[model samples]
Target chain A: MSGNFIVGQYIPGTSPLHKLDPRTKLIMVFAYTIGLFFLPTWLPVLLAGIPLGIAVYASRLPWRYLLLGLRPLWILLVITFLLHLLGGSSTAPPAPEDVWATLGPWTITGTGAATGFTTVLRLAWLFSAASLLTLTTSPMMVTHGLERLLGPLKRWRFPAHELAMMTSIALRFIPTLQEEMDKIIKAQAARGSSWRYGSWTRRAQALVALMVPLLLSALRRADDLAVAMEARGYQGGEGRTAHHPLQMTRIDRWLLIITALAGITIILWRWA
Target chain B: MNGMLTLRDVHFAYADGTPALQGVSLDIPRGGKTAIVGANGAGKSTLFLTLNGTLRPSQGEIKLDGRLMTYGRRDLEQWRRQVGLVFQDPDVQLFSASVEQDISFGPLNMGLTEDEVRRRVEEALIATGTEPLRNRPVHALSYGQKKRVSIAGVYAMQPDVMVLDEPLAWLDPAGQQEILALLAQLHRAGTTLVMAVHQMDVVADWADMVIVLQAGQVIYQGAPQGVLAQQERLLSVGLTPPWPVQVFHDLRLAGLPLEGEPPLTRAALTEQIVRAWPKK
Candidate 1:
């Protein structure tokens, strides 16, 4: 199985960002997201975009991967932009005599346009920051970071172990599922199931036919996983110890402090 | 002497009323390599499952080390640990996130100490020659490697007898030889082996005993030579003799002097053919 293809696919490199501890990357990502949300003006948006762009470049990942990650949310971006353009009239008019032109002869106005542009910029910043984090850090590292961050919660009866297990499994199988999908598609194609000449509903039904086998195979894989886990002596997440320990280095600490300061600065500027 | 494994008049049908196995009876002595040969849908896999207590027979009893096994859930769990079953599909057998964890699964379920489990994991990896693949993800290994890992997973449990279902299926010639050699080595080391296979060559050359299943019934069970000698009986069930046996039969038809039955291995066949040839 081509097990390396999935969302959050880490590009292995020797970049400084890649060397940072996973905990640092996790905290930085959270800080960067919060800062993006609080940025009130285009100035902050442009400035925030700088670190994200540098991070992406330094990680040496293809730019198209970042764009691909946003493909699913493209419709949402467009919807928000259109809504902001139409909803501006409820607040204030830009001009009285030229109101119709400013509002685009219907409901779109100057305020709506501004809001739409800001919303798009904010969405871009959030996605870019997230993509950078994923590209820079391996999934195992991310899971390790999560385990560390959630370690204290274990005292409160929280399922830190189970949650970490789920994360690792998701990381492990997402690529497997994709590879299965590709194989199923190839099999269907071999059987003369073509999507090219089908009606809209027919195409949808064909997709359903394709998905049934994939889902059934996934269920079988899950059963095998349960059996394998049981055979290995995994007894419900108790008394298991990790082989690799998580340690935070000096670069990790510095990165965490810088990201935290950036977050505070964004919040203060927004409130002021 | 008590047999290590015994099945008496075992009958099984699927939920949909498909009769998979009917009145199957066999006794597997400890520390011998036994091969079960049959066509697809001939109940070989069903028989393997019965050994491990995965599928209980409708009628008949399965006993391991003279102890009869019941179909109850508690008993089934205990019986399963005593018999390791390596499934035909490596993909199904290996579902762990990592190879080491997969191998340690059975030992852990048996409640071995952590250190013991680790030691067994290391030993199993070495036994299967997959020690370097310990850290590799289960899904990342090749099909042959995955098969070895699956075998290692079962081996780690330290079962007295190992049941393999079509161990050579989908493997290349080199892989087949490697696995066949490994099975022979295990048998020599006194690990009982019960393998289901379709390859007559392997059954003739490697198995100490051959059991032929046709339409879910064992028609013949004995040494490989006696089974091969029943040409018409084997032909009735859509089975052919091994290549050497077929060649021997042809040589006999050509009026060659032969003292006894033809051999199964290449070296034996060549030696017999040279001996039969007229002195020049």
Candidate 2:
């Protein structure tokens, strides 16, 4: 269960990507994902890799680690690719000349193969772009950026600051809870609950045993945390100001412009 | 009695009607090192909670610097700013993703300007010697580091009184010494220090005043030298006397003429034993 948990683990660095304001990264990633869906041709999908490649290089995070972040999604990625490659669900009959390969009564057409290849490429582009944001920016920064972005919605009675606080707290407690869950699992295993090699029903029972204690402890922790927070004078987000408020530097501004321009260019290029 | 914080016959019971504190009253001296000692479920934690206004007493009153505590929204906010509490579990106290952010929470919540909050956060990181881990994720910190960060979080508030619940529990000797040194530093800078601790040696060596709670009541509160001498009372409360005092009692029982108040610490005990070495 713990093996593939890689998304939120931040690797501290002084790289340019790490220094960009989280808002810029967030906006870029959002626009980039939208742009990925609009790419009209397989070549454009492959070309989308150029900016992602630059981002990976600029992040200075090990490319190997970034690829490893995709480990859990490989199965889905492959399934999507194969589904398109086989054209198994397509209703239209394949043209005779357009057939690329034939295997076991399924004819793989040029269009289906192209679609499959581009879809995989597009999926990789989107995943890496989002992971880059998580890798370079601390989760607190992400929350702060989100809160600032959502600040205008305060008029509609939106609880942006509270939601951001929740996200930050959740991110902060993830590892603590993970460590706790590990302890509970080990403890349950010691008490003759075969968590590792049990039959499906037994494993499910072991999970229930583990979850009950974990949940109770989490609640107790939350109670203690509230008292501690109150003692330190936290009433609510109202009237509270950030110590490290988000700042848009020249780099952040330039990156914002460039990303917007690139996104518009991609959409326009697809149409043109 | 004049104190930075004073409670008078304060009573508290849980929602389930478990009495955690019953008619407890005590004074925490300004700029003094105070240790609260108690057996498990003796209401040490509850008493600390009352001191900071985290838990309102059911029937009694608490005063901060002679001002009566009121649980109004603004009053409670002001009261919390004056008295900071650090929980026993650092994991529970640290809610921000990184050390710097966690330290900033208190100052930010105080409605300080961004610049002032930043300054306080920086000062706290330096005071706790956590500047190295400033940007490090909270979970990446070791247990001792998390404890320091938790202290830093409260310290950033610049409160007059710092109340800690079992600050020394679960720390190694070196970690305990580090925390004691930090507390001493804070005390020297004029912060009132109140901690509930289990180590009698620590209480004897570090605390100027000791308060012992038993069964939701204050059984003994006095200077360390005076409190350690009441071995039977502490024993009846399920607390062990400092080892030096215990050894002194055993020697006294064996007919040694060593006198002049049982030594509160090992060094004092060793000195007394050496001076009174048998001259036969």
Candidate 3:
């Protein structure tokens, strides 16, 4: 169970991708997600690897590590593939040339297999791209990037900084909260409140007993953190200055330009 | 006048009307080791929070450095930075995921430039011997390591008065000794070190001044040797008297020849025994 938690799994590295301004990486991920969905041809989607390869290489992370990071998503990917293969467009006949097999009302068409594989690939790409962002950028820098990207949204009266700050704090506390949850569960177990020793309903009822205290403690910790922050002179969202200003360097601009050009070419190639 | 923190008639009750502190008044002298000893829920934590402006008094005043500490934003910020309050749980006190970020949080809140914050973070990381764990995730750290990181977090702020609640609680013996040594370092550096501890014997050898709290009020405040010397008084407040105090009590009960006030420490008690031993 502990092997799968990845909310703040930022591996400490000094790769070029790690050095890129968070905003640049964030924008690239955003554009990549949109292109993954809108690109018209499956071949181009498969060929979108050139830019991803560059990013993977620049991050200096072994491809195996990136794939291993996707372990948790494999279940969802399989589900997506199975659902598409078994349950889509019941009335549509398989293209005669594309039909590979037919078993009991389920026609195994090449198109179905292709679509299923495409969906699975898209899901994998999305997950890996998102992981790359988190694996390289620290939570603090991610929040800074989000705040900078959404800075213009302030014109719409959006609480961009406040939102980003909440994300940042929540990101920071994810592991702490997870550990607290583990401790609370163990403590409850020690006190003989068996979560798994009883009937399903009884175990669920036991979980309620455990969850209440966990939530209460979490809230209490939040209050304590707020007080600590206030005491340390955290004023508010506005007029707060940064110690590590998120300024984009020339390299960041170059990366952004490369991302735009690569993204446009991929989408155009997909359409053609 | 510079470092004195005084609380006068500070009364506080929870929203449900359970009284936590009742007219507690005391003066926390500057630049020395002070311990607030009390039974559980005797307002030791409440007093620490109140001193640092985290809780508002029902009807009383807290004066820090001769200035009234109002609840205004600027005033509270100044008071908070000056009086770093370390909660009993390092888990709750630490909000940042990384040790370096957690330590930097306090200094960053002080509005220090990034370079200065980094320097302070480095200094604190070194001070607490957490340099090796500087980039490690907070959740990956052990309880003792987390405690050190938490202290380093506040140390980076360079608070004049560091209030640690149960500083020694949940620590192993070696961890306890390490923390005591760290506290000594803090004392030598002239940060007024204040801790709320449950053990009576602990404050005896460390705290220069000990304040005993009973049922939300100061029962006694003076030298540890004086307050901790009375075994009966210590037991009355849910504390076993210090070991030396108990030894002193047993020796006096045994009709052994002993002079002066009861010793509060092991070394003093040993000397008392050697001097008062049966004539050769």
Q: Give the candidate number with the greatest lDDT.
A: 2
- The estimated TM-scores of all candidates read 0.78, 0.92, 0.91
Taking the candidates in order, what DockQ does each have? 0.26, 0.74, 0.54
Ranking by DockQ, best first? Answer: 2, 3, 1
Q: Which ten residues in a row have the lowest lDDT in candidate 2 chain A?
A: A1-10
Question: What is the descending lDDT order?
Answer: 2, 3, 1
Candidate 3 chain A: 10-residue stretch with minimal lDDT = A1-10
Error of 1 at B73 (Å): 7.7
Show where candidate 3 strays beyond 4 Å. A1-8, A82-101, A155-157, A188-194, A263-272, B1-3
Please identify which of the two predictions, 2 or 3, would achieve the higher DockQ against the true structure: 2
| Residues A129-158 of candidate 2: C-alpha lDDT, one tens digit per residue | 988899898887899899888989988999
Model 1 per-residue lDDT tens digits across residues B1-280: 3478888899999899999888999888887788998778888988887788776788998888888888665665667667788888887777556798778767766766778888889999998899999978887899999999999998988888888999999999999999988887777777899999877888877888888887778877788878866566767788777878778778888888755766776678889889878742
Give candidate 1 misplaced runs (Cα > 4 Å).
A1-7, A13-103, A106-114, A140-184, A187-191, A198-209, A219-272, B57-59, B67-82, B97-127, B131-140, B156-158, B185-190, B217-221, B253-259, B270-280
The clash count of every prediction, one per candidate, is 6, 0, 0
lDDT of 3 by residue, A16-70 (tens): 9999899999999999988888765557668766678888899998788778877
Better of 1 and 3 by DockQ: 3
RMSD of each: 4.7, 2.6, 2.8
The global C-alpha lDDT for each of the candidates, from Candidate 1 onward, is 0.79, 0.87, 0.84
TM-score rank, highest first? 2, 3, 1
